[model samples]
Target chain A: MLTSAAKTALYGAHVSLGAKMSPFGGFLMPIVYTSILDEHKAVRTAAGLFDLSHMGQLVARGPAVAEWLDRLTVNRVAGMREGQARYNIFTNERGGAHDDAILYRFPEDWLIVVNAANTAKMWELLQASKPAQVALENRTPQSALIAIQGPRAAEILAPLCGADLDGLRSYHALRTRLADGAGGVEVEIARTGYTGEDGFEIFLPAGAAPAVWERLLVAGTTHGLRPAGLGARDVLRLEAGMPLYGHELDEDITPLQAGLGWAVRWEKSDFIGKTALAAQKAADDYDRIVGVVMDGKAPARAGYAVHADGRRVGEVRSGSIAPALGGRNIATALVAKAASAPGTRLTIEIRGTEHPATVVPLPFYKRPA
Target chain B: MSQPADRFYTKEHEWVKIEGQTATVGITDYAQSSLGDIVYVELPAPGAALERGKPLGVVESVKAVSDIYAPLPGTVAEVNAAVEDDPALVNRDPFGEGWLIKVSLTGDASPDGLLDAAAYAEFVRSL
Candidate 1:
């Protein structure tokens, strides 16, 4: 199955670390190094390193870049200041999400980080919709992204990074150099992450990734920075209430339906899917995503039926044991608005039996300030 | 890890130690290791009938779930409360504390069709 999948520069390092390899987003990715629970706890408590090179990096330049992109996505792109990053979503004609992305504004260009699975689709869409003044480049293959996440992440990275780590605010990015053995490599350090913790995502050339990875590992030994994999990443993101691409947002699921109305800028003059999104927002009766906490020990899985009042209401979109929640099972389910209230009672059908579950708030976990 | 020579094993990685009319059943070490950090276990209740090669319970890890199969036809005499309460026991000691159920042997309860320890070790290698 992995014969045709592409591998990142850190693939050999992962194999040497005895990571369990699996095919994800057309790439041979590490699912776990030691244990998912251990890695998940490390990210929550101390620090965790991630090889996120599989995510797509698209660069857009030219004077009309922001304006052009603003018309394509649901968020306001042109209003973003340089060195700022914003979460946005590209929607289709029906206001359904094409993909959720993070847009980083630079002095001369814009960097859009997209989901790995949507790389090809987003690239095609951007190329097809490009105006004469916009220059679009798919830099995914040439770029590598490494994220250090946890409460102690900044402490672990401060000694090696040349940037003012203390001054960098959240949702911001700065071009800086990271010291390697021979001089250093130019990198973009972004104080942003999906793990709902204080962290930084470093982007650099693919060729320099391995050395930087090794250096970070060596420097992070005292802070308990273990190389985490996709399994832990999924659990961390889910607990943080972040919307995963295929689960919460998809071609058929709009941002509003996925509880991402905060990202949609209604004041934007014109954008793709604006009409449909406005209609849905105005109607406010669509089936939507909600958090479900299982009252029993059984973990609700994706595609499991959800019931309310003895009738099928929705289905589980994602589920996992939230180690942050003291091993309680948590899930995201798309259900009718009537069943989406915070205190609503629901049942998740696991094999042939329905287990009791209750609707709660979006995030099942939050780090201490 | 090597299988215990005193018991019999099935192709599905379940081991059974037949003692008189009773049999003690649990998953092999290879099975627990492959499953990875079991978080929950579902075993057949006491007095439940189990057919050979049929699913008797489930073992769930953080990312996946697998069904544990019966190695011999029998009625469940007792279920392991230790494993059900703390699933990590299956990963720590699959052969001892993680035993799933104690069964009262039923029809054709002889271990004639099961693989002996030497044969079972060879079978695992072939996999």
Candidate 2:
């Protein structure tokens, strides 16, 4: 079976490290190194390195950049100052999500990072809705992205970074160089991560990825850093209560129904999906997202039905045994508004039997401040 | 990751050790590695009857869920409670303490259709 899926710059490195590779989002990505549990725990306790280059990078520049972005996403893009990043979603006319993206403000252009699977679709959407004055370019292939995330992330990268990693606040980014043991290699460092822990995401030239990835692994060897794969990343994000595009937010699901109503700014005068989302907020009558913890050991996988009062109430969108939570079976579900309240009792149908579960707060885990 | 020479293997990646009329069954080394981090295992209770090529239990890893099939027609004689408590034992020792269940033979122990250690090793290589 031959696959035409694209490979990242670190493809050979992953194979050399004995990683289990699988097809994900149009790319052959590493799913695990040694084990998902070990990598998941390593990120929570020490540090973890991730290759995020498969994600799409779109840049829109010119004086109309801010105005164009304001009409494109759900968040307030105009308010973002240079060096700041904001998380937002692109919704269709029916208030359904196209993709969740991170927008970073720079002096010349607004960099939009989107999910790899939706890169082509997002590019077409941006081009069709773009203002004539604004320029749109897909920079995914030209750039490489890597993230070193955990409580000890700064301690591992500080020695190699030329800038002050300590001063950089969350959601802030800076232009810096990494010492590859010989000299400074130009890169961009952003204090952001999907895991709910302190970390830095480095963006550099695609050609420099292999060298930098090796350098970071060596630099963090004493800090218990491990090469984490997408399997660990999924569990980490789930534990942090983050929503993935395909699993949690799809074309049929809106931000409000997916527990992302906060990201949709009703205060904005006008934007895409503003009318439909406003109607949803006003009605407050639709099914909404809820976090649930199973009373038993079995995991409630996606598409599993949820029940209450012997009737179907909803379905699970994302779930797994939270390794950080000592292998607790946790999941996020879209249930009826009546069952969305925290502490509400519900039953998740795992396999063929109903398992007792309770509606809890969104985000089963949060980093201690 | 070595297959014990005394055990018989199934094409679906199951291993069986038949001693007289009692047979101990578990997954092969390749199956455990492919599953990655076994978290839970659901096995049949003692006295339950199972037919060959039928699902007798379920083994769940962090990545996926797989069915554990009965190698031959038999009734459950014993179940490994230790695996229910700590599923990692299946990954650590697939042929020893990790054995899923022991079944009492109700039909002819069909050793004819099963693969020995050498043949099973070749089958894995062909995959």
Question: Could you estimate the TM-score for every candidate?
Answer: 0.97, 0.98
- CA RMSD (A), model 1: 1.4
Model 2 stretches with alpha carbons more than 4 Å out = A1-3
Residue B112's lDDT within candidate 2 is 85
Docking class of 2: high
Report the error of model 2 at residue A145, Å: 1.0
lDDT of 2 by residue, B1-127 (tens): 4789998999999999999999999998899999999999999999999999999989999878899989988999999999999999999989899999999998777788999999999999999
Q: How would you encode candidate 1's per-residue C-alpha lDDT over A138-240 as one tens digit per residue?
A: 9889889999999999999999989889999999999999977679999999999989888999999999999999999999999999999999999999999
Best by lDDT: 1
Evaluate model 1 with DockQ and give the value.
Answer: 0.78
Candidate 1 — which residues are off by over 4 angstroms?
A1-3
| Model 1 chain A poorest 10 in a row by lDDT | A1-10
